[model samples]
Target: MSTAISEAGNIPVNAATPVVTYSPVVFDVPGRAAPLEIKVSAPATGTDLPIILLSHGHGETNFIASLHGNAPMAGFYAAHGFVVVQPTHLDDKALGLRDSGHPEAPMFWRSRVTDMHFILDHLDEIEATVPGLAGRLDRDRIAAVGHSLGGHTTSMLLGSRVDDPEDPQTGDLSDPRIKVGVILASPGVSDEPTDGVMMQRVRMLRFINFDTMTTPALVVAGDKDLNENFSTRLSYRSDAYTHAPAPKTLLTMHGAEHIFGGITGFDTVETTDEDPERVATLRAMIWAYLRSALYPDDKAWPAAVEALESGAATSSGTVESK
Candidate 1:
């Protein structure tokens, strides 16, 4: 962890402050100058907080987890110890990850890739304007975590090899600025005929993030999840990892469903009663990923992941997410 922060504006320091939600900050990318939403978590105080860019999947995106109220699943990371921010892409729909354009890269190119790069740029902009946050944020230690389509965006950030690459800002997944790598309840990369394989037909490959990713990448999926589904997602993802040459790990929430990947699914006990095993798998994998990715030197994360693979936490905290 490095001691360096950038400025967007000078946010006041108030420890133990009640939750504060603000209107979304709309930003534009460089090339297309497309509009993107940047929502900041209200911090009580302190400059040393680590920042995380939370992204939503394809369909509908809620920057803050208001509808769903789970800590690790919701705004709890910010409450615990993280400067959380989520951006809404242009293509979010009522049906999660389902859009008319579907998997076409150009449909939401600006929203997915360009807007993402712009958000990072604004993190600097905010750091510039916010004196308190200056030197407080570990700029080089930033990490991105997303679910479903959001995970695809994160892959672009992590340097996945994409065939029909539309986002021009593709950079090294292991760039120094990013010290941690994470993928939540997302489908894996593919060479097979699975869901979300837009560039499958392509013979040439252009990486949005890239192969041989140097940053430790975490790939997670729900077992019973049928959104993009586990079989299709994992097949493509595992194949990519096998060939990429990067330090990576894969985790599956045994029998876990897809909806439980984000805040929405974790909102209520009644809403999450579909798959108990999957619920536990979601927590085990996501929790461990955070601990491991955020705190690389910590041994507990490895142990937790080990337990998940062994199928421990099967019925206790696990529930099916819709």
Candidate 2:
């Protein structure tokens, strides 16, 4: 595949080679009361294809935070030869777990990580459920991609650990099976919680630690995403990239915001920046990053970085690596 980013920010999708999608693929979790539901999308043809476990961001909208959202990104990845699997976490508004008093209520951070792990463990069953998808997935090459709160989930799978103040010796939940990750608009490290209702709603953000985040990842953040409710500075959103070790990259979108140009859905009201070109740029960059990270010898990542630095891709973003 070429490393060039088209003006429209999309690689041509062959209409004849359509993508197939399956939703609500049920899998029973051993300790969970409800079976896990997922949406699977893949190219009509291809074998041993890489897998992308897409974790949806928690949003005010009921369905956007569930397996039903992010069709634009998922469809793009599927069309580009990746098997994308998105799970509806217990925290999804559609489940109405708020009044149920679910143990992982509120953030449901731990359960979110477990959801991704459960999906990886049941890939065989998931593939079998979809017609013509059997034995087509490259189990060995897997990556996790997430946005916002979902990005926090992706970080844990990639070796990031959260220290429990109450239990100092708590073990890390990092899953070794995930080879790489891409974190978009994820929460940053904070010494203390922000004042007011935002703190009560997202209390878990203050305890995140990036020292143990050893996996190779690409951190994408927006310059104008000054999420005042979460942090005092806009740069706070780039913490995942600034604090992580080498073999990590930071893609700072110049005029972007939390939604990153409507990636959550097509023409959704949540998008503060509605530039389709920006979304396309994000798609192209992510595709290049995943390709090169999965294969050391692949030049797509470096080439794409060069394009960004040289202003060939677009002047709206800048990239840095350590």
Candidate 3:
């Protein structure tokens, strides 16, 4: 190990603090087909705890695509002193809306954006449902972490705009409440011919404009996440960081795949690169990055980077900031 603490405290990369989790926090929203369901996770004891809205990816799996997914990431964030809220977006396969012929059937990109806003707007209600969590939240210190298609949603929430002429809901969907975002294995622009094949296939993706993504965020990309269905270029996933303006950071994993060491869930077959150490490093880096981003004075981000560089954590990847 690098012998460097991730932050001012001697918190190791693999620190596992006790966490409490509550699921199926239901909310009835207007104009929504079904009730909104979410899961909440937080440290057993903490006050003024920051918030992390974890948006799950649109995977082929039956369960991980919904609020029940991303336990590995959500649990870790909660254990490390953050209130993680995960919602079951309308696009989740478990909802069985794929063949319903709804306008946003397959992806529900717009609804995904709205779901996040709803979560923020009702933080008080969300907190009141869970015991010991009612007065422990720090609403001002909020960040978002998303993976895959959920990453695209996070980018949209963090100031990435779309100017689709055919779509009526296409506009500025960014939320000012979300201070920082972590985009993992998200889609990139399709400027080149061979790049972003999936973008053309996905209706909303054809109109994505990353030039307006001014949010301060950390984009995590895997060097080996080359899916021919999406794009032939390895840099496709890092486009959020590449096209975004200053105040951005990119963490390029050395040989990781789209799953990035199985972030979707624990021991799920969807993860092609199943390295537990790599996942631990990823969770640590995410916790540290959000910690520093929400609290600018905190040195957790830099310290974690130094630890990764010095071989303190597993050699999962390299980090760069702009």
Candidate 4:
């Protein structure tokens, strides 16, 4: 009921800009093997709007990127007037090393990295499909968002600094146009590729033995998460506040689940916690960080957080998590 009411509304990517959705197009990013399912929608009015591309975690393992199915987050952002892209990584089902051959799939852990770069190369995705869409995406002001495995991608895009940003490295993170920071939730292991898990991404950020990072960042995870340690470390957690050479923020959800507050694709009411109050708090933190980093000078964000603490964020009728 609440989703019906709220989802019916529209988010202004620009001032009173009429938002529109183009017919869906399915394609894969170059260099990867799998064919990605992508659909873009944005404001029709000609104005420069920020672009936010999303990469879902291993769908079979975590159910992060299901399209036209039960659980999905790409639509949420696209509906908010963003040019959203969802890469269909069929190789994840095999559960082996990163699909180095997949077009959109990152080689090794840098799959998230390639996803961002490929989207930048094909900026006309929205325009080619949807008319009058060029002005909506200000390529210079772009951001990346990922969940679980995808969350790791978010870190690669926005963290302090990569050891050699210009080394012509080719893997999951060989992009050259990542400008803004990142938003990562329930991130997986990202320690230097020493004895860490084989699935872990090889992080280039300074904290991992490099010098320092130049990009701002934010990390969010549930204390009850399954991969809390990896998530925390990647997000820059320390006993004391260790400000990033670039700005950074880290958050932990006390009673939340391993999946960063259980924002499922079903009904919001069906989420692990029917208690929207707390769940909304987590969501507010993420959305606010995105707004501040991507859409600066937006005051309503803080107020939205306050309201979401017990209002819309938690308004979902789902029961509280155990």
Predicted candidate 3 versus true structure: per-residue lDDT over 102-147, tens digit per residue:
8788898888989999999999898889877989999899999999
TM-score preference between candidates 2 and 4, better one: 2
The numbered model that scores best in lDDT is 3
TM-scores of all predicted structures: 0.66, 0.92, 0.94, 0.65
Tens digits of per-residue lDDT for model 4, 34-111: 555555656555467666666655544334343332133444444444555555444344434344554334323455
Query: What lDDT is reached at residue 134 by model 4?
Result: 51
Any runs in candidate 2 off by more than 4 Å, and if so which? Answer: 1-17, 167-170, 192-197
lDDT of 4 at 55: 61
Candidate 3 lDDT for residue 131: 78
Q: Which residue segments of model 1 deviate by more than 4 Å?
A: 1-21, 30-34, 60-74, 94-111, 128-135, 165-175, 185-210, 226-243, 265-288, 306-322
Ranking by TM-score: 3, 2, 1, 4
Each prediction's whole-model lDDT (CA): 0.50, 0.82, 0.86, 0.47
**Model 3: ten consecutive residues of lowest lDDT:** 5-14
Candidate 1 lDDT over residue span 7-92, tens digit each: 10011111333444443565555543235555666355656666777776653234222212233443545554566666666555
In terms of lDDT, model 3 sits at 0.86
